[model samples]
Target: MTTTTEPTARPRTHKRVPAAPNRARKNPTRKRGPGSYAVIAAVTVFVLAFLSPFAIILVNSFKTGADYRANGSLSLPEQWNWSVIGDVWERVEFTQKLINSIQISLGVVLIAVVLALFNAYAIGIGRVRWRTAFLVFFLGVNVLPQEGLVYPIYYLFKEMGLYDGKLGYTILVGITYSAFGTYLLSSVFSSFPKELIEAASLDGAGRWTILWRIVLPMSWPTLSVMCVFFFVWSWNEFLYPLVLLISNDNQTVPLGLSVLQGQYSSDPTSMSAAALLGVIPMIVFFLIFQRSLTRGLTAGAVK
Candidate 1:
């Protein structure tokens, strides 16, 4: 009887135990913290801020002046019209301006690219004396704003009788643009494979022969990229061309656009459309040669 009572009392003293934690299930359905959402929101805001101005420009370009003034600059237009581009073109004499732009841009590209190639070869590969000094001088020139040079150049051009003509202006721009090309092309030339150059030298190749036969042929892509950049820069150049080109006949696209601003200052739509047209060639040029540009930029950064 005593044994049976002791066994029953032991059953009454039993306690409950907790189950083990799930170590095998690694972070199932992890909830994103507030930081991730904040990052996404910030990036979206940054993108929108940058794009808003261009979006407004494109939208406003399609609307009439009346609508734009009535609805404000950011409002959606009741009507969209493509004819504004044509009207602006006719008023601005777009054809002549386009021709002038092309001529000036081509001249700049040709002169700058060719001179840059020769000068960079001398400095970068040929190891010319005082090369670092020359590079520093060009760097100083490159950083000097066109505004600072305008007065000096204006006086110089007047003295030389080159102030208001297309050829003279083109020459001036090409020379200024060559500063950038020289630096960029020097980098490209400096990055050329030393082993190949040594091999060619061992093969009895003279400097001129190496430049023309090996360097020039191999660097066509970089040359093309530099040419395109030079062309675009010369095309969009406003101040130098504006100050130098007083004659209506010699004015380029940017000058024409400025003229339209005075003539059609009240008509914002027409002005924007014409401005858009002027930049279209640049956009197209970049799109077409983007691959080459990308390649050229990367190809000479390393041996």
Candidate 2:
């Protein structure tokens, strides 16, 4: 007994545990190699190349026609002739054109978003019969060439006595644009959580109520993105406006800008000024809505 007790007390050794790794020391920051520097340089070159046109336009816009001709577009102006912008604006009736563009863009955004919401609601949330067929029809409409539809649209508008009018053009473009909006929003709404809708229904919410309260609020980000897209698309449209809006009073900014070009000869500085002016509104619009666009794009990636 005594020997056993003494043996138990003789030696009690503890096994050593290995220490945890120093994560920072083990995974040092990677040093940039030749490949990384090459990629960065390539990206910088591409960015500069893309921006060079805008830079040229801005620089030439400040020069007089004589100065522009003497030194070419790439050279700095001897003196900034700020009057070129004002002159171009007055020549093109730019204020009216700007107003027309705003009207058409806002109208298109409103009509397209509303119609798209209703159509997507019917197809996606309502689970309407032949939903696939409806989706396919929209896809067909989207892929259909605008050039081919021009003749038919022109004839139809003429018959309706709405040809060459801003109202008619807005309606046609809004409807045309809605096809895309519907297609895009339907896919989004189809994947929307049905639980929220079911719960709202259990609380006696009607379809209209559910759409207005639940669906619309949740889809605001996407709707905002669509609005911005529709605005830009409508603003930039050239072919339809050229064909339909014949009256100078009803002409959009693109049409106004086109008037600056002469078949035989045109003022380079004036054209540059007009180009700069034409681009500014879109740039402003983009800046204003950039946050919404970013939010909409990132929304799908999160909850």
Q: Model 2: which ten-residue window has the lowest total lDDT?
A: 1-10
> What Cα-based lDDT does every candidate model obtain?
0.85, 0.93
Which candidate tops lDDT? 2
What TM-score does candidate 1 get on C-alpha atoms?
0.80
Task: Give the Cα error of residue 103 in candidate 1, in Å.
Answer: 1.6
How do the residues 1-303 of candidate 2 rate in per-residue lDDT, one tens digit apiece? Answer: 354444446576788888887677577789999999999999999999999999999999999988987888899999999999999999999999999999999999999999999999999889999999999999999999989999999899899999989999999999989999999999999998999999999999999999999999999989989998999999999999999999999999999999889999899899999999999999998898899999998887213
User: How large an RMSD does model 2 have?
Assistant: 6.0
Alpha-carbon shift of residue 138 in model 1 (angstroms): 1.1
